[model samples]
Target: MSVFNSSRLAGKTVLITGASAGIGAATAVLFARAGSNIVLAARRVDTLKAVAEHCTAAHKQSGVQAGGKFAVVQLDVADKKQVAGLFDQIPAELKDIDILVNNAGFVLGVEKIGDIAESDVEAMFAVNVLGLISVTQLLVRHFKAKNSGHVINLGSVAGREPYANGGIYCATKHAVKSFTGSLIRELVNTKIRVSEVQPGMVETEFSIVRFRGDKSAADKVYEGLQPLVAEDVAEEIVWVASRPPHVNIAEVFVMPVNQASAGISYREPKV
Candidate 1:
């Protein structure tokens, strides 16, 4: 028997930030397969459209008669004007979003505190913290009006346990953790569900971006280790979204078997 209650997700609308790649794109596809309409938002409209096509294909393959529609929106969450006017850009049919996945986040570098560039810190916080808060605020208002919705944040193990050379990234995720916790408390009396999925060492473009396109450095980070992939984390996000109404998956920490913490991992010995 399947564990997911597909009925719960059918016909639901999900808005995913950073849907152009990584966990965001995977989540969009998974939700589409479950018969959910998706709004794919990211800076890369071309990539977003490709993801949308995949979503459509997934939904069709699922043989679901209803839902699974997609909207690809060019969004730079760091842009306040874009975030403020996001709904206007979305199609009217997808405006009533049932789920908001705050997954648009990135890390620029691995520089330590003293050596970190000012621009890097600003960029990290702008997208990871402020951008997430902005999008959530907009959706929160809508959810409050309807008294129904789910907010799933993409956090990181860095949020729980900080490590060297990841100060800014860790700080941003820590803010995400605090924000999610506060949101849960604020919505305790309401039907709105707030959850956070904190992943550790997911092998995605995240490391590449952190190292500024140095593939070798990024590869070394996961060398001799089987890191969690984007699909693994996406599954967790969808599972939390598919739970029964009364069951709120407050927080989930997902890491590979070899990963014990943000900085601790068991890598295979070099031949």
Candidate 2:
């Protein structure tokens, strides 16, 4: 086994949403390497399959002759019916999962409140807010019955501070924070742990999606300076998960060295 994994997460089942790309995909790889069986769910079947394969490959690369199992489910967490159906189809290996990474979320257009489309606002709330809650609510019952599990919600710095033209997105993230917070209290005195990993300006498909497929605009968001990559945030997720049973890492605020907050970064001009 890789020294990184050390079988620390051996035999655990981890479920990751938004596992088709970005931090979700990266986290699946890291956790699999750590000896966790992974269940990857995303809206894109083709992309989710690739990520699931990558998870098993990571275990092989870690020198484990028998790699951990990887499962994939095409899921749209924003759709409650789909979420329920997706859970029903989980393989035995993924049942009573030890961890739930609520990473299936998105940011819609970055326009002023007035200019933002109602669809954008609704979609953001549907996925980023209610979607997270739906998944967590379902899992909460499961965890309570088992009296064990961990929940890691993917929040953002925007959740703590809103930016111009990002009000709707920020509001969605803010709701995430609130939901996770309440979860902590509800799960208090239980073996279940609740945590949030709020990232700052990670350069992922998030930017491209936010810009409506404008690659050049997405590129500019990270031009002239380093931004947190999905892998960087993935490492943090693994680290937090690997903590001792007694240690519940309630929150982790991670960012590049150049970033002090959301939309507040020190970037040098290109020559």
Candidate 3:
């Protein structure tokens, strides 16, 4: 038998943004294995479809009750039109989403604000901050009507403290932190739960995406020390989402054993 009774997760639906890769992808898999119907959305249709397929397989093998669902949507969260149309496209069976993971975020160019390209700054804000809020605005309506649901925003250690050359990205994450906090307060007195997960130095395609597929540049980041993997953060999200309805996990700061803070790390020399 699967770890969870199918009935426990039967009607629970989880919608994950940035589900094409990294923490988002890993979260989709974990939630599926635990029996939540999944809706995977990302700009990369090919990769997103792969993740959606994994969710279907994971749920099927994990004993999700009859009619439990899995779906994929080609979504560019930064696009107002796309975000606006997203929920409308969701299948009826998965309409009452139980969880929304605002995990679509990225960083581009490790350069000071002055040296940063205009496009990079705009991209970061569009996807990391406004994009998150846009999705939340739409979903909160559904959640509020029921007065029950969980919203998990993927923040970063940078959000807690700004780093050199990552000013714009950090600023955007800070916005996420602020937005999530305000949202929590705004939704107070309702059973709607809101949480943020701030992770430090997770070794995922994050670096690759940040550097635009420059593998060597990305590899240099963790050459000396072990960093947290996508799955590590995914486990934390699963724990947060699984908490009792009345117990809202407000925030989680996850870091690798070798990492003490956002910028502090103990790395082996020449490793």
- Backbone clashes per model, in order? 0, 0, 0
lDDT (C-alpha) at residue 144 in model 2: 92
Best by lDDT: 1
- Work out how many backbone clashes candidate 3 has: 0
Q: In terms of TM-score, how similar is model 2 to the real structure?
A: 0.96
Rank order (by TM-score, best first): 1, 2, 3
Worst 10 residues of 3 by lDDT: 1-10
Compared with the true structure, all predictions reach lDDT values of 0.94, 0.87, 0.88
| Runs in model 1 lying further than 4 Å from the true structure | 1-3
Clashing pairs in 3: none
**Stretches of candidate 2 exceeding 4 Å from the true structure:** 1-6, 65-67
Q: Give the TM-score of candidate 1.
A: 0.99
* Better model by lDDT: candidate 1 vs candidate 3: 1
Residue by residue across 193-212, what tens digits does model 3's lDDT show?
A: 99999999988899998899
Candidate 2, residue 96: Cα displacement in angstroms equals 2.1
Per-model TM-score versus the true fold: 0.99, 0.96, 0.95
